[model samples]
Target: MPRMIFVNLPVADLPRSMAFYDALGFVNEPKFTDETAAAMQWSDTIVVMLLTHAKWHQFTDRPITSDGSSSLRLCLSLDTRDEVTEMNRLAGEHGGTADIDPPTEYPFMMSHAFADPDGHIWEPMWMDQAAMEAGPPAQTDA
Candidate 1:
């Protein structure tokens, strides 16, 4: 089978989380959504599962931590820099806040971070293909 990744994140509320992700242009997969879990599919290999705190805790023994007052960050890349800024603006309009100060203009790459409804950070990044080709091979965990 092809490789796949399912990122499970704890959310305080399902509906609000759904709305937040919707604003980010992520389509929710109803087939995998329920009262406790909302599946946000970015692509074939990228599946982000937004699960309620209680539901998430059921899968792990560790206590679930509230996102409030926490500065942890989560990063996700995009295809273009315009998409990054657009998502950031859309996120802010839909109750998400920019995690970073402002847009960073670079010759090769661009990035901007945003925090979701529950203060969970999300970074949208873009790296120029030409610049990447000029550099070393990208690193991967596997």
Candidate 2:
């Protein structure tokens, strides 16, 4: 079986968070979803677990952050720059904030940052593998 990554996040509203992810193209995995938590699958190997404050507390003693601050940022890679832009648009159309920061662009890549309703940051990016491997073009003094 292929290795998988499960990211668990504490959310203020379970349903809202699920809807936000759904808008961004994640499908809910019913086998791992319930009233207190939801499993949103981004890909076959990537799953995001959105848990309510109470449900989150059950797994850790740490305090749930109420402020709009995030300790970590998550990223998702897409096939094209257009897809990255579309993801950001979907985030805003649903419930999340779009373009928390200006979009980043390079000859080989593009990225846009967004924040979920609970303030978790996510960046949707696209990269040309061949160009990335070739590295940035060397600058020449004119």
lDDT (Cα atoms) of all candidates against the true structure: 0.82, 0.93
Give the TM-score of each candidate. 0.85, 0.91
Query: Cα-based RMSD of the predictions, in order?
Result: 5.1, 2.1
Off by over 4 Å in 2: 135-142
Compute the lDDT of residue 102 as modeled in candidate 1: 72
Q: Give me the candidate number with maximum TM-score.
A: 2
- Model 2, 1-142: lDDT tens digits are 9999999999988999998999899999999999999999999999999999999999999987758776888989999999999999999999989989999998789999999888889999999999878988888999
Candidate 1: residue 12 lDDT (0-100):
83
Model 2: how far is 136 from its true place, Å? 5.7
lDDT by residue (1-142, candidate 1, tens digit) is 7798888888888998899888887889999999999999888888889999889888998876663565566667789988988989888888778644576668788888878877777888899888887995567998
Clashes of each: 0, 0
TM-score of 2: 0.91
